[model samples]
Target: ASTPSCGDGQCTLDEDAAACADDCPERAGCTGAEWYARFDPITQEIADTREAIAVAWYATGGSFDAARTGRAGDDPARTSDNVWTAPSEPGVVTLWIVLRDDRGGVSWRTLAIEVG
Candidate 1:
């Protein structure tokens, strides 16, 4: 059987496993039930390394938002590059991220998600 890595945001691999034993030594295990992504080497070469991104979660009544502005590294483990979880409710959520130039113009990548 083959397990595919998801760059398409539909499915993802367990990314928080390595930190579990160390961070929660008394706990049995750590589970990462979230999406994961790595910066494409080809994309990184073309874009500014210090690019910024914004993350937002949409729920029934309102939205939750966060941002990683103008900082860069290729590590997917970093929270700044991507999100860990979507909303707990079974509704729509959106992640809006951007790789920007020094002039701070808008360049966006929108991830539409459904959470349950």
Candidate 2:
């Protein structure tokens, strides 16, 4: 039940909250690509808007549309509890919470949930 990793140069961490942000250079406005592994959205849909929810979107194991920002409610760290619904595609559609450590290495826990 782990999420995928986005690695460095492709993602960032939310200092205030316990979430990660994906690097999407093409995205406009405050919206950016992002993903999470541990946080589940389905279980959080009825919770308060302030709760953190895991989310991501991809196509064929590749980057699709980056996650939109401003969805994390009052959280100022740019983190969100939103669920990313990707377009229907072929191959493995991987989603994950890319984490970065002090060593500068990246790690991804597999969240291989197939997408159309």
Candidate 3:
């Protein structure tokens, strides 16, 4: 089987932020979630609904307290948090966040952390 290559504008399952930084460019300071207004058929009104998001965290180096974290549709939080333990060695570490919504929406973001 042929291996996936970077710079193809696609981050395949075999590629990652660390291995393919160009394909998975860094999006600094992004929350990876958003709220939108939707029409409620039952209420016959437009309601502001926050998307229920789940974040799949990946990193080249370091350990995360949780692999995923997010709020449900009913939850009001606009953001989620996870704990990451940096590696003992000081160097640049690549991290990726795969955000998924209940409405079949998906996106990803990357971060380059300097561990020193």
Cα shift from native, residue 27, model 2 (Å): 34
lDDT rank, highest first? 3, 2, 1
58-110 in candidate 1: lDDT tens per residue?
Answer: 33423444444333334333344333455556766665555443334444555
* TM-score computed on alpha carbons, candidate 1: 0.33
**Candidate 2: lDDT of 33?**
27
Any runs in candidate 3 off by more than 4 Å, and if so which? Answer: 1-50
lDDT of model number 3: 0.83
Kindly give the stretch of ten consecutive residues in candidate 3 with the minimal lDDT sum.
Answer: 25-34
TM-score (C-alpha) between model 3 and the true structure? 0.59
Candidate 1 whole-model C-alpha lDDT, 0 to 1: 0.40
lDDT of each: 0.40, 0.41, 0.83
Which candidate do you rate higher for lDDT, 1 or 2? 2
TM-score of each: 0.33, 0.26, 0.59
